[model samples]
Target chain A: MANTETALKDVMSSIDGAIGVALVDYNSGMALGTLGGSAELDLNVAAAGNTDVVRAKVRAIELLNLKEAIEDILISLNTQYHLIRPLTGRSGKGLFLYLALDRSRANLAMARHQLKRIEAELEV
Target chain B: MKRTLRQFTGRRPPVLIDPELLAGPGLLDELSGLRARVPHLTGSLVATTDGLVVAHDTRGLEPSGVAALTAAALGVGARLAEATGQGEFRELLTRGELGYTATYAAGSFVVLTLLAGPDANIGRLHLEARRAGRRIAELSDAVLARQDRD
Candidate 1:
């Protein structure tokens, strides 16, 4: 199993146009680890805001009364792509991998594929 | 099309209830209306923050099991998101070989789950679902309040 930090670093380096990457806890809206964000982009605040998004979606699902599993959430912005992937493995429940990329240089399909790979190898 | 939550609740009594500071009744009609719009959307559900089933379409699936699974997934997803330092998780989508499953936020009180076949148009589905989820949150808040009044 890949250590969390090394696994994260590998993903960051492999993906082009990756502006930032983080491991976040949707439950508490906290970032356990982060890399590559600059002065204008604060990973902590982004983690909290995204937590709201996750919470809201889960609530809506309950109201509708559907039975399904969530894999990943992709937010396509004008110039960016925010990918929120919920870890499904037993060891990684309640955790997610968030990746931010510049649209111009990022390949969404490849990015998603790579993230899944990283998730498989990550050691929690 | 528009339907009132009163009309829906009158027709189908909710399966469960939990009181809290949240949205109200108008939200339910909006959820029903949303269900009406999506053709391939097999079902939808709302669960509390702790992952209890609040309400559901319940076409043929087990409501409690779904809620438990969603809650478990949410826990893992949240942890993975934090471990990587990417920030808070906004949503999660699982694309299985057979179908697709998605979870979205509905304020602080609930989570929305959408299950669709391979043919479902993801882009359009996401847009409509998000709108519907918000409407439900508002309705849930109202419903909780009405119960309080009684």
Candidate 2:
């Protein structure tokens, strides 16, 4: 099992063009761990704010009657790609990994694949 | 379209239905009916914003604690929506390894929470839950209105 801090560190370096990364608790809107955000990006605020994104989507899934599990939620912008991956295993419940990547340099498919691997290895 | 608490009142409304009224067979029947109509619904309950359990049909879980957590989640959900310009908070759903928990705003004072397996039909759950929520609101509102008169 990968430690929370170590796993987050791995995510920052392993994912290309990673501007910032945070492990957020949707339950209380708190960031359990964070790495690599610039002054323009407030990692904690980003983490906390995304809790609603995770929540809104989950509710939407229920409302829409979709039985599928959330693989990742992607929000694309002019310069950035915000990727949210909700951890699924028993230990990972109520938490998700938030990754901010530069759209120009990052590959979306690869980033998602890496996030899934990190989620599987992550202990909590 | 989602309904905000603002539609009911300019301010937060107090719990109108008494605890005794919550435990009434009428509400219990409504909850049971919702569970029956919706596939994969393992349990259901109604709780106040502060986490007080008004009525429940939960199995193998502590109704009181779940009610309180639902209130907490609702608070965060509502604030998050407003802050992000996502509009009013209507419902919240969280998936776990074992199952899913979905909470809906029943009315001004109480929220309806439902539990379901991963395979449960998400569409049906919402449809049935919302219908039950309307009845719950009417029943609770009427009781509170009567109390105000007395």
Best by lDDT: 2
lDDT of 1 by residue, B34-58 (tens): 6787546787777764567776775
Error of 2 at B108 (Å): 1.0
Instruction: Compare the candidates by DockQ and give the number of the best one.
Output: 1
Give the range of the ten consecutive residues with the poorest summed lDDT in model 1 chain A.
A24-33
Model 2 gets an lDDT of: 0.81
DockQ of 2: 0.02
> Model 1 segments beyond 4 Å from truth?
B1-150
Per-residue alpha-carbon lDDT of model 2 for B1-150, expressed as tens digits? 222464332355543445665556778999989877765679999987667899999999999999989977888888887889987778898988877899988766778999998665554566677778888877766666666677
Tens digit of lDDT per residue, candidate 2, span A40-93?
A: 998877865677677779889999999987889999999999999999889989
